[model samples]
Target: MNTAAQPPVGEKVRCLACGEVFDASISVCPVCGASGEWLALYVPETNAFRRESEEIFLIVGGGIAAVSAAEAIRERNRLCSIVLFSEEAVLPYNRPMLTKAMFDSLAEEALAIHPRSWYEEHGIYLMLSKRVVSLLPEERELVTDDGAHFHYDKCILATGASCFIPPIEGTGLAGVVAIRSVTDAAAAARRAEAGQNAVVIGGGVLGLEAAWALKKAGCHVTVLENSPRLMMRNLDAAASALLQAAVEESGVAVVYSAQTDKINGTETVESVTLRDGTVLPADLVVVSCGVRANTALAQSAGIETGRAVVVDEHMETNLRGVYACGDCAEFRGVNRAVWPVAAEMGACAGANAAGEAAVYAEHPVPFTF
Candidate 1:
């Protein structure tokens, strides 16, 4: 007797926290770790317009923005060649999960934004561990660090951002780390040991998350904020107080108005000395400073850059046929550098590049912690 096959088990769901669309079977948003409450049933609008062409679409950086651009392009054009270049050795994954789920087993398969089979089925080429060193906009060509060259009809620069580590003495210590990538998170996790003293510099959301993760790993975690309060930019006074209480209740110590003079150690991180002369014993130090947009490649190509590469509403750069999005693109002098904004900008850029009309509108970012 023949048995009936099981129907598909998951539907498309949009994460409210980061605007990432994923299968609903997943309990938490793979991008931002938002629970089911932040997920909404989503039915993608089918674009009836399709242009079959041999044009090559090139995307730099393997972040959410690059993935979204590829998806948007595939949605509009089925025959175009799409190639994505990434300096990372692995496929695109949810970056926010790096800090939010620091201690978890982040196997590439579990963290990937889309499975490897997804790229193969969609005809998108994955050029991993390839860093684009030069952009020749006039010739519509790109040169990688390894001297490989590729030509494109249209290009999107989503080089994203790099973590800014402040100049502090002893930062080169072995136990001092920053949480920026899966590899960085793994290094931090390896250093987090029971009964160890972990000092986290910066009291932003990312810093707090790392502190909590270290605390969970049985490390004595202390968060040092240079500002007067925690998340001063994102939270009001009352909310900040409430959050501070909650964080302290979770067994993580919080310090305000902290200025680090230097990290102290002979070989590894031994302690952190504040400007006030108070020294906090630390076995490991995690720096959660902010990030700066990666705009050197665009700047070298004569692209206009203020805080980042300037872009119009369509996410197109001053150079025609070239576009930028994510942390690398600044529109109206604003770049929130958030996941949702990056995804929206990338979708807009991809649509316009595919000969479809799409505009990006700035919106207020929703904060969920």
Candidate 2:
């Protein structure tokens, strides 16, 4: 049941044209499109892993996906060694709360998934403030930003996405920001003071949430949406109109069908100019367009990727002994950047990595913001 790395599974399959090592099962090299004999397999001896030695499962990322994966792995095999590398200094916490309740006076410890002692008690190694730089799939190794090298029998990538800042001028101004991390939330809270003007770009969930937060902070808030309606992906015209009305009743202004040409000011941002020649005055602006998957590490390892890392039903990547989940992974060419989907994928990936049988089927239900 344990889908551990076996002979030829974790081996290097090189492309004759690109000279890149990809998955053997891939008939054509994902990089150069070489087919047939052009793809060659090379399996090495399993001397690196002794039967008596304990197996190690390495997870790169520090989000819901990574935390869920660790829990799933522990549930399957208590004796196996597990190391979770997180780029953030803090422990995993409720990410959604960062924007949803930015103004709420939440204590630092309250954000964590569990107390620091939980990982120790569960025998999970939590490596905080560590960023994995490169992946050597052929050697089953990963190198951290600090020059630390780690070897693993099975590895899972939960490297979550980053905010997508559009190509808008004046983003480098003093008050412009994106509410993605805890630190960002703190900054926004400090800036969104009473008597100040704030504009939020993008009418998505985060944008609307941020607008609400700023409004709650006693600032005059305006939401600029490029689309015709708010939450267009989730709500139809009628629903969007109702939601917009509700939001406006809360003392927030909504602008729709807007095309931002530039954010202008002498020093700090003073106004946002739309393509239609209308200008909105603002002291601060928050951009909440969307997010892009962190696929640089996976791509460097020759792992097949589209918008996100591609995975099979077992949550395993094309490369054997490797798996990917969360916003950073694409299933059947679609990436669902929602928390529920990420957690499900992570659980399936972790269970399979621990030699437990678990299959991941995409959620049939539709998502709404």
Candidate 3:
């Protein structure tokens, strides 16, 4: 189960329009606007599987930490089975590239680090498009959407975070998208047409990235922020201004100190009205406001929660044999949800799950994306 690339009931399906391999069952594309139906089915030619001894059911919430943890476990326990369960379709892929490579016209290669055979040779099971619905920490088990439960010696909750969309009046409109994952990114591209007015809420990294991606996709992009400046949490005004100017130079609009209220339209987003009585027309609205960690499964299982899943220095939770990582876990009082740290934590969690004392020391990982 752990050493193969099949999810509980899923596999790779290549997209015909973008020519990228995406999870077939995942309804939407994160890179392209292609539907899952557009993902050409490649019927398995054979049932050949390369499995190993000792199954380690690793229920990963986010792909990066889950995959990194699997590699670390494989480094020590070569014969142990590794199951990498991710809600994200892409497995162990880099999140940073969603910004830099979004407009790269011919980039077929995904942000994934390892090839398919790498998992096969090493006996790693990749479960893409699999969302863990509940956790049984007492039983050391996790339940999937399809009602299948997996028992584990160690379980990693890398479930990550979901983008927070403000409770705006017109939020139910058709053209609004949350640019958090690949699915959102691709939908934004399709929802926006050439010369359409697109408004992005929040001036965070994902907002800026979505602006760039939408602009490349031929939409006129405008960013709305309630903060007095851009990237307020990460950069000072001067640095933010430099980035703002750069984005504006690329034909994107940046409006600061603007509080958003509702997206206005009949069936789709047409304009946005601010709390301060300002109105701006928009054909598409991308919400990159903030992120809330997905801890429902853990919370349901009675695991204590803080801002996120409360984990110790070793990525272990309050419960024994249960661990948390990625965007969901707050470890050693640090709540930074960057990609690199998630991978590091995952590796540590996996090692500990395999009966080793893996310490998850905090490292200052740079975050430009």
Candidate 4:
């Protein structure tokens, strides 16, 4: 069982999915349940290049990018004050596991990216459940929703992204939802009753994962894809065909070129109506549309933004002393909102924010089943 206590030091492994470090003896990640194959030997970084400074580093968001930025900042400067603000009530967690381990008892401790002791020991002040409402680049100040203001010398924005919900009727119903946070996952799991019908809109990787999770919970699952094939953006025709075959073999129904018209129900989801007039009964509906980068805060602060907050190779925005990374940032007109890219971008942003030169090189983002 995962707890708030720190893991034993020495010879540990880190979960690539959630960046949770634990004893190497553990076969599966206690936090995300990722297999041992995803574990890597954890080697603690030495502060050999430490440069003492009093500059305050403020990181906004509670995702892996925020945590990575904090770690990078600490590596180069030990005495610098690092303040992390997360809107979530719980500590930063492994977000990708929400659908992958939907049925697991994902208490705060189990989902935490690192034990609370790590932050305490590193002197990283965590302001949980605090939403930064405004950013004043000129004043180097930020205002939270509670009217509290904070000042920083340098700031990193890892505000991440939110799940995009396409316009569809009846989405406000109780059983119709999207899997984004732990709370969403828990709600979906509760609705995944055995022998009940669950309809998933979108045939992307996330939609498939959610479908499989509901199927594992004994729900009759059906996936709807507006495109002619599954994972159209990621998989070619041959690969998509192979994946569809495998998915259908697992007892989940797949419908191609299925455009949803609306969700049908009163207070709870009862069924989904397709544009072709086909109705699929659904006790629960999960929307797996793509995500949109959370760039409103950056844009409102007069930062350049196209699809997301535009940044240079160093992950620095147009404004000096300000940087953006993770899903909320775009480099060279591309923003691959993946874990590896976010981590790399955060490291570069943090390093540059700490008076060190760092460059983020563009690379092909990899996706796995």
| Number of the predicted model whose TM-score against the real structure is largest | 1
User: Which residue pairs in candidate 4 collide?
Assistant: none
Candidate 2 lDDT, 1-369, residue by residue in tens: 978545355456765554444456556554334687777775532322212227899999998789879878887676789999998888877676787668875455756756788889888899999999998998899999999899999999999899999999999887898987788888888788898999999988889889988998899999999988888888889998899899989998988998989999877889999999999988889999999999999999999999999999888999999999988999888998876678778888988888766778775543323
User: Which residue runs of candidate 4 sit more than 4 Å off their true CA positions?
Assistant: 1-9, 14-23, 29-48
Clash number for each model: 0, 1, 15, 0
Global fold similarity of model 4 (TM-score): 0.92
Q: In model 3, which range of ten residues has the least summed lDDT?
A: 44-53
Ranking by TM-score: 1, 4, 2, 3
Q: What digit string (tens of lDDT, one per residue) describes model 1 on residues 1-369?
A: 758543257677888876778887676787777875888887888778677788999999999889889988998889999999999999998888888788887789878988999999999999999999999987899999999889999999999998889999999999999887889999999988899999999999889989988999899999999999889998899999999999989999988999999999999999999999999999999998998999999999999999989999999999999999998889999978888888888888999899887889888788754
Candidate 3: Cα lDDT at 134:
82
How do these models rank on lDDT, best leading?
1, 4, 2, 3
lDDT computed for candidate 1: 0.90
Candidate 1 lDDT trough over 10 residues, lowest sum: 1-10
All predictions: root-mean-square deviation over Cα? 2.7, 14.9, 10.4, 3.4
Predicted candidate 3 versus true structure: per-residue lDDT over 177-256, tens digit per residue? 88666665566666767888889888787788878878887988889977877888888889988987898799988888
State residue 17's C-alpha deviation in candidate 1, in Å.
Answer: 3.7
Give the distance in Å from residue 291's predicted Cα in candidate 1 to where it truly belongs. Answer: 0.8
Q: Please give, for residues 191-211, the per-residue lDDT of candidate 4 as tens digits.
A: 888999999999898899999
Model 1 pairs whose backbones collide? none
